[model samples]
Target chain A: MPEDFEVNPWDVKGKVDYDKLIERFGTQRITRDLKERFESVVGELHPMLRREVFFSHRDLDLILNDYVSGKGFFLYTGRGPSKEMHIGHLIPFIFTKWLQDKFRVNLYIEVTDDEKFMQKNELDLEETRKWAYSNIQDIAAVGFDPDRTFIFTDIEYVRNMYPLAVRVAKKLTFSEVRATFGFTESTNVGMLFYPSLQIVPTMFERRRCLIPAGIDQDPYWRLQRDIAESLGFYKVAAIHSKFMPPLTGTEGKMSASQPETAIYLTDDPKTVRLKVNRYAFSGGQPTVELHRKLGGNPEIDVPFQWLYYFFEPNDQVITAIERDYRSGKLLTGELKEILIEKINEFLERHRERKEASKDMIEVYMRRGKLATVMWETVHGLSV
Target chain B: MPEDFEVNPWDVKGKVDYDKLIERFGTQRITRDLKERFESVVGELHPMLRREVFFSHRDLDLILNDYVSGKGFFLYTGRGPSKEMHIGHLIPFIFTKWLQDKFRVNLYIEVTDDEKFMQKNELDLEETRKWAYSNIQDIAAVGFDPDRTFIFTDIEYVRNMYPLAVRVAKKLTFSEVRATFGFTESTNVGMLFYPSLQIVPTMFERRRCLIPAGIDQDPYWRLQRDIAESLGFYKVAAIHSKFMPPLTGTEGKMSASQPETAIYLTDDPKTVRLKVNRYAFSGGQPTVELHRKLGGNPEIDVPFQWLYYFFEPNDQVITAIERDYRSGKLLTGELKEILIEKINEFLERHRERKEASKDMIEVYMRRGKLATVMWETVHGLSV
Candidate 1:
């Protein structure tokens, strides 16, 4: 029993090893050559890709090959609606929005309202449904092209999704899912069937699909690839990102359940400052004298990691900040203040877009390109 | 374990004992007092009920009490579309039609296209879907009032049914379903989730629901009762019928997979005669002289059981035939000829109605009362 870290669809714990995860999950690393190839297709890569934050991949080369051959690939991603949205939840969506812009491909966002209700005891169907609608506005705030994007919850669009979901579930057996998901006899049947629904959007288009999500969701794509080939569809391609470390320097990702430990997209500037100052873990020495003598470790510092992961886009500025922090020139208070300002700036713009998105939620939530492709393929509808 | 008979939704083997099944399923036998109560509500009982072939019940007394108090109940039953319908498959529909006509209640018929695809090894999604549409015409042939009846396949009506199905699935755990359905690790995840869909129609109406089906489907209602009260819905009442004996004199019911031992609703008169003459189990002695001297057994005779179970409507005529056969006055050939004539006559009328129903299949298949109720309840749709 290796207890150093555990990851599945439902739970994450301990300090995760990214390289080891790539090895264990049987996914390929995003090599320098692959990065250069991606750069050729979409111009200069996003900072997340350059910094290895969006670190690992499955079938990236194949998707690149298809794209270079004049065939395009769309994107698939999702959120489980159980609580409020945090900046950690926005990580993939922000990057995904960039990809959609660069590639001009359709993107489908699945809101797993059914999965939330099935997984949470206190969350009823209505509560989860309401959360899904709210989460849709947060996602729309990322500025996805409404004409090419579709956002659907399982309950609302089951008529379009379930026919294909049944086909996927028909190909799967209990033993196969149990092994893939580590499901026990006490697991609810809805959870067992849910991976099939999640897999449907990957095959929603005739072209290839590239999923941008945290590495914890890799197991579902692994199962999808095993069955996709036989179903006459392309295996889904995925780009896996590292977790956004929580403010308290937790080994795993930030979670919505602990409000104080996470900086939500909706959090005000004062709340962000208070959380960062009070709870952000630091790696500096005990005193200013000892701190100047012994350099700090930036890898374990939450404020520095947050900047490096998302906020600090300029490489030269980030390098200087890291060097100053490591040499004890930049105090912990200074680094915290830097992160707080950048986050508040981002949230201010995001809150405006979110408010403006209130009316457009219905547009993105309606049937769009991906839904048309799926309905046409499944029902022979003329779009 | 008793090997004399077997019964479940997916498989039936051996000779089933009605008495033993009632006890094993923990259901109550319909006593004369209950029969009298039912007679008071629906007029003189149908022959199927009077003969005790449609024998056991779960909560029939409450349904009758509600009916007497003018708080009515609706009928719910279904078919798994794995293959073409046989005469044995129509027994419940015929009896249910009588109940619907007598009580003038709304009826909801579910064609389990999803369950069939999940359970069968060779049937594909499209095949099962086609079978479901075809089977809907056969159900409509039973003369259900199209205005008051709603027939839906799991695939077509999932938009309206999935919300309630999720609520039901949340209340059930894997272990409970495995125990109830005898599901093993090899069972597909869809089969594990199907009972939730099957349980939805019970809660479609605000009033009580009475499901009339074979004893094989008892496990689903048993599960429904376990969670129904907590959900603030009435526990589904059910009327259980014995299986219609196969033409081959198999201990269990007729199967659609074996064409020779079963008479399909589409079979011609000559095919029905051939099946009855060649495959119908005989209870008479081997030699003609020995048969004339010795009495035959109507209790184990497939042809006699068929007449007693469904075809023959006259009790005095059936009794006379049974007595003549038991006294050696009627031979096996004579008994089989009588069953063949009765079956052909029944099928003639059924075929006419089925052909006539083809045009109205679209009408009966459209969104009706139950779908509107469910869609409004789940989606707040005003139309």
Candidate 2:
């Protein structure tokens, strides 16, 4: 029987089967040959690609071909500034930074402050704007090339995007977005019109735009592909990644409301250690003696899953840990300790970079080479 | 019996009854006392006001109270640049100019190029933008105070207005606009969101905003009144005018697609004379002998209506014309000649002013006192 799961841009639930999602969403799997092709061009694959964390794609091969042929491609991704940043929130940005570094191409990061305010009834514009500033700092900590990356918030940069957005909006009817986004008659007009703003950055460059985002966001890309070519731009290309499971279990993605189920980027070292020791779902036997005899199931473990998905990148190290856990050599406490240390180290480096990059955020948002050009130019139909 | 008429922002049909429209639209009649109050302050009433062409209002007394009590109000109006403008299109601007000259307050004219493009399937942004330029020239020819007036197109000035627009949009829902603007599910999202942009200028200043427009536009101001106080601004005030009847008949307002039913601002003397002589709906007997025997009905005559509405501003001249036409002293051909001369002379002066005020258009759009300040400010929630 099929696994019980649901996923969309707004909500995700239950245990998702990644391969089944590829079939259900009508996307192609990241086959071994395609991985080899990526490695051939970049000289090596990032850990996310090596481990198949990003396992689904649409028109990605075409993007690779354009890059190889010197036709070029660019990257676009975004954040909805509705709350504080968590570790799961940074996963796609970390992978996107790697893609930008290897390809030496431009990247545009849209912080959708306007959508966040319009989508949530309790959140106001000032609150979303505050979160937008803090989230931009976390994204900046991912170490993207400031000269090549341009970060913008929807409310601040809308003037440059609205002309093109209206053109895209005209091609779509309320019926189309209502079906694609599951919008209802009660949805505010601002929220209903927001998809066009989200689609504008993909057409910022003439070349193909490759988006590195969670699989749930594929619907927007599907809508963009339907209209981009008609507006004198290429259909957007996208690579989709599975969500990082919550710390307490592997059934679904992290929840921002449940503070215990996820680690925040601002969580201190002590909080990280305590949360891991107290809450990380273990697959070991009940007692110490029983775990030594029966061994642990690393396949169902949250700590091991988090490490394999992001924290631990070394192939040999992860392999050894898996082997030891399955053979009754590693205890549950010991495994939890490993994840705790890895998370604290990552958070420490992220915090330090965020503290030192106060001026760098300005570079990425306004004064950088790519950002300067974007601010001076208004994106619209070329014809 | 009630008149068989329809009125909305997008469509106007039948012969509108001014007295019934006031009751139907839930607006107050511009009473004789209000005209006397205007004369008390401004020394004399404008011909449009004196003759009751602008016959209805909402909160005109409050606007006057604020003006006399040392607090002040401003004027707001707009145009949809879907096609070339005609004499009917310039009615509100002409009255607004009179208000600005008398009140010496700021004026904001929104040229909605984006709305026109979204509302009409066949019109493109480039085409609407072309009309916006030509239409703004006609508005400038009405001779507004360039230092105090600011004219902006939606596409070009959206950056400054969008923040406030989203604030206003958040207070509205799809259901609300659908009911107010007659929007359906098939309406494009851009068109659904356009009422917010139109409402933004009403909140540009802290004092009340007085709008001089056709009664069909009352729905937009009504929506604005519902949400303005919640956004920390006063509810807008308005003065409503009647539509100038088409040349062919007095059944409906002039249409852009039916060129012979209206006189274009660019129409030369020959075209004006030909259209009026050929198509002007006469309220006379079928022949000259019968017309001399039975008096003409000036009430139903399109030429006499045009003179009463705008052309013959002199009280004595209009009264003499009305008396002579009612007594059969002015024949149909003679009355058409009088209207043709008035329109051609008006067109000649308009064309001359449009040609000479190229620099004045710049001042109203960008450089002069109010335009410069507006360009530097972004309107949003005051708190």
Candidate 3:
């Protein structure tokens, strides 16, 4: 059977196509405060100041415009469950987590089970639940505090909060939902209402919401901000990131569903070594001589981008690899060998904390929900 | 204040205008089973197989249609937080509580503290909680099983069940809601979503929703039914009562907002007697000769309507009252005396048992919520 078309910002490779994402999101003016917030999150100056992998923004100017007024908001970003969770997946989560810790405001890392369930034809809740749990671990591994963060399943809260869900449902329409989600006539009502569910924590009457995600999801955030005002609430803010290509295959980006295309969080050392060596989507030829004359194209080389995101806090190693590749002295296999060792060590630490991280995930989810829940309780329909 | 064109059904005079209600509901056939359900609940078998005050429906047909198709569904109904329910409020509650007992299906009754807060424009949450508890006792007086019934307050469940509410909101629009609730744009968003909140229980996959209200609320049910099909949901069934005119006052129905217009469930014999003798929308004449010739119009007498609702379970007393009233053999004072004695006895029994009944309400609320929570855990999103 043919696989149905399944492309959402949270899933699509083009989810981070910055220009198109901004057009789609209808966002504007990346502000100085957002940049400052970005700097505060990263803690140090970037190697590529002119090149922005973290792209697009909304209501960012408002924060800057109000900076002298001494008011600020919080941050939000999330995952669509645990599919592969490669380095591509970590860019936004890690950065957003950093922003949250630095800013000292509420953070909400939503796990979009309801989005996945509605987008997928099958109602395999267990798979969704599994994906949620695994993705939560990845989020926790990114290091958000249990006290300041929140994660929740749609079904869990839908059961717990009938009145609130109903209030949100009334503010939206099929036309608006379809516009936001790219829903077709065949789209389920669940999907139609799904965006509002994501946006709800933002309006919370009290907790000002700031979203962090790849540029692709900016459309959803923009829709939420508009609807919030209609519901008589505060406009939400967001930080958007650029796309990171998968290391292999022609599927456009890294994906666990396509094994050769991406490296898993649990990738064994040998597997990582083999995958990088064999299918890193090289810019160089099979023979070294042909490649020396032609030179390497940095744009399409997945290994270079991978190094940028993962070979962090160390320029000596990253520069050496870049110098070797520029001079045609470092063979693709040699680079793979280096990444294999680097990635393996990273996964080793991840696994060490993976079991201990269950409590961490629980804490993020519980705390995140508590912040929103507490605010919602006090301000609810009255606000 | 002119009260912005008052239409509170709690203010209906001697014969409710069913045709006007049906015209407003805009349905051709409300279905026979809905009427039968109401009759079964009200304990009055209409000889004409007639539809009375409850002239509109939403999912009443869906329910009838479901029953016709041999599928079982539960009934849903609830009340607002009346501090101490008067004789007027029990017309719907007693009937709905009976349906819960006979049908052996799930029942959910919501106490709308959220609605009261908006209506009274007050913020005393403790008083709302107090009213929730107080109203529960009056609800328990009708005797529903604690195991089968669930009672919820807007404050308690809104946060947990907002997803269900989101569905309701999606199916309805602001203009549509305004039309149902009779408000302008300045009305609180909480009131805008009030009908949707009332509706969340109907979509309760575990509990079938059947609303018990007055004909004044018919517009809300009519809109709910149309939207249910649009959203692929079962409609809420309804049992609407003709209004219960007040014990005192010169005109119209009982109203809690006006102290003289209602008989509180806690009123003692002295209060009942005094109020009845002095106030009850009299049909008596100023002169003895004129009264003898004109007699009394029981149809226009508010006390007779109250007696019919509260005092006469059998036809004999009603017929005798009617005959004496038309013949002028019964003075207005005599009729008032009968009503006062009947209502005093009724209120006394309720007051005596209220403390115990209040305890039962708490148990019912906890058990019902537990059942609903479990159902959603295993079965997934119901209204």
Residue range B113-208, candidate 1, lDDT tens digits: 889988888988888888888888888888887777878888878778788888888888889999998999988888888899999889887789
lDDT of 3 by residue, A297-341 (tens): 545567766776554436786777777776777766666666677
Q: Considering only the true interface residues, what is the Cα RMSD of candidate 2 after superposition?
A: 2.1
Residue range A14-117, candidate 2, lDDT tens digits? 98988888887888899999999999988999999988889989998999999999999999999998889899999999999999988999999999988888
lDDT-best of 1 and 2: 2
Could you tell me the TM-score of chain B in model 2?
Answer: 0.98
lDDT of 2 by residue, B159-270 (tens): 9988888888888888999999888889888888888999999999999999999999999999999999998999999999999999999988998989989999999999
DockQ, per model, reads: 0.61, 0.58, 0.09
Q: List the candidates ranked by lDDT, beginning with the highest.
A: 2, 1, 3
Q: What is the interface RMSD of each candidate, in Å?
A: 3.6, 2.1, 8.1
lDDT values of the candidates? 0.87, 0.91, 0.63
Q: Which pairs clash in model 2?
A: none
- Note the clash tally of each candidate: 0, 0, 33
- Give the range of the ten consecutive residues with the poorest summed lDDT in model 1 chain B: B374-383
